[model samples]
Target chain A: MAVREGLLALLDEGPRYGYQLKTEFEAATGGVWPLNVGQVYTTLDRLERDGLVEVRGGAEGAQSQKTYAITTDGVAALGAWWEAVPSDDPPPRDELMLKVLMAIERGDDHALKVVTNQRTVLLSLLQAKRRERRVMSDDSFASKLVTDALILRAEADLRWLDSCEEQLQTRLRAGGTTRPTRKADR
Target chain B: MTAHTLPAPNHAAVEFFDVVKRYGSGSTEVRALNGVSLRIEPGEFVAIMGPSGCGKSTLLHLAGGMEDPSAGRVYVAGRDVADMDVTDRAALRRREVGYVFQRLNLLASLTALENVSLPLELEGVGVRQARAEAREALAAVGLDHHLDRFPDDFSGGQQQRIAIARSIVGRRGVLLADEPTGSLDTATSDAVIELLAELPVRHGTAVVLVTHEPRFASWADRVVFLRDGRVVDDTARTVARSGLGAVS
Candidate 1:
């Protein structure tokens, strides 16, 4: 959907050959997102079939040479796309959370161990990302931002692990079992 | 052999062997550190992370000879810290230990150069030689041009750089920072963390940083996690220059 919408938005500016669309899209994303010519043309073909774009010129040569222009409908769609915010209607499943829940189901000790083990792995990944961020030149802002997002996500996971540990400890101190126990019949 | 004559094996910058620290007495006694053993090789960067009251700062205090362990031994640059008398400990701190805190204790009135060179001057290094060394330290932190500027004249990040320069000014063997970036904004904190990361490579100083922020801790060559005065985990960075194994 991103590529489909992206190509539509690109065509809205002016007619562009397939190769030009690929280069401009890659450039617009600070060269961090790579789009091959075949994918670009495929997306363009879908847009054309959907009435979002039309073949303008260079139809006699290779697909890369074919110029595509956005239709009137495409302009309206791009405008709507700009105005629309990303939807999170369906909450996404996170693997770490799932792991913690499963571990809790197994019992408190297992959960604590899981959190500690995950912290080790997450810290290793965070260190790698930070090291990569260090080597990046200042001019690569897009690359740095991408790396920053990954780092922040890992940190958040770590904080959650800490919280999990604290909660597990509190339950243990209270002499509570993770699972409910059966009462004896009177 | 006597503790004084025995060097820390393998040239450790700082080493703790079964260290235990307690506060108060008897029923009221709280173990601030419970049998911790760790080592920092020369020029290695290690970060300590944990919940509050987990003894992260206590570990650093012992490393810099600020406090003696209740049991076991602590060594700084191969000297037994517990064996050293008060004056020798003070001398050890002056010559081998440096500390930075969440709040940089930079004197506001002094210029950057004066603040950095003050430690050297206190140790009886001549004013001229101390100032030259301070200049080099400032240059290392990329603040050479602003040597004469007072702390107030610089931005927060620049001020932190000045504080860092002071910590490493005398070529101290160990640099201990307790949440050095706790007061800075994200961008400024990143810059400060980057500067701290450079200390080991640039000066071969063994650096110990205590921080709750994983982002900052990631910059260290190893991360030690403490819980209730015990090390729960110790992880070395995968791409560490020394390839030291985890201590856990």
Candidate 2:
């Protein structure tokens, strides 16, 4: 998502055509950031409108190729955008939590079965991702980081699921028909 | 049992006992409803009139069991609605109460028939049976012709009629109208009120209408006036004093 601003900053180094910028951008980010030709052109047009970059006329005969250079305003805007841009901290969106809540509301043994099945599937997925991460090259730091984060989150989710199962068992023993009351409601 | 006499077991359709609703807390606390106790009889059509911020809607919501009374109980169809959980209360509303609001809140994407079938679908009724029942309800509202049309395609009165059809489709015993005729012109409002008045006698339903206009309230069997969340006055009459009676 930061590819557009990253490309703009790279263009600040010197005037370059779309393909040249694309290649340099890939090299800078270790190929983690990929851009289609269409995306590159679209970002360029947007940059030009924001007064961050200027599109100079191409060489006399080469009408298809146009060069772009970042303006002083563009450089300032990019710096501001970089400073203003908050770090990505993706929140947990546990579908398992939703499933458990609805299941408890339903107050049936079927919900417990669904939760058990889902946990098994999730554990298998976590193991496979871990195996894939082990074979990945040490140089692919971004790929390794993404995979490690996913595995850790999945493990935490499994722990939560286990606790939920224990809670469900306790509830089932007390009375199968009783509704799960929210703590705040009590 | 005499042929003319009905059973004594049939009690009032609505009862509120020492009901209190407070907003905020401590120094800022505002009591919207304060120990309000009242009963609405079965087969009677009543209108609640009040000024803004007088807890008219809140009272209606409590009577309909949409919200819980902070200190007291609300009973609908002789069942203690306050004792039920939120989900059960919602089910009670779906099965036993019909609500009509000033704004016809019909989904734009769904046709009139689809809108009417929603309550039944939510109640776990079969799709075919729900649709059949929805069709019957629409016909009762004289909207069978407009069943296939979307809410946006119909006029305001027509859309409101569709909303009414949706509310009554489940054959709910108690009809709660919250400013049902607020947005309509005089003629259309009269037409809607006429349809509403006829429903009780026709289907043996109880109606509780909330309105600001005395003219609109005139169509009710009794008018209960609320000022500062308390019933300031109520009519002694047993039927609507207006000229129109039992529409054919």
State which candidate has the highest DockQ. Answer: 1
Write one digit per residue (lDDT tens) for candidate 1, span A87-160. 89457678999999988877788788788778877887788777777689988777788888888999999888
What is the per-residue lDDT of model 1 for residues B18-125, given as tens digits with 9 covering 90 to 100? Answer: 999999999999999999989899999999988778899999999999998999899899988977999898888878998888898899989989999999999999
**What are the lDDT figures for the candidates, one per model?**
0.85, 0.76
Per model, how many backbone clashes are there?
Answer: 0, 1
The regions of model 1 sitting more than 4 angstroms off are: A17-42, A57-66, A137-141, A170-186, B1-10, B108-111, B145-150, B237-248
Assess each model's interface with DockQ, reporting 2 decimals per model: 0.38, 0.00
Tell me each candidate's TM-score: 0.84, 0.52
Positional deviation of residue B74's Cα in model 1 after best superposition, in angstroms:
1.8
Q: CA shift at A67, candidate 1, in angstroms?
A: 3.9
Q: In model 1, what is the error at residue B226, expressed in angstroms?
A: 1.6
Candidate 1, residue A44: how far the Cα is off, in Å: 3.8
Q: Say which candidate scores most in TM-score.
A: 1
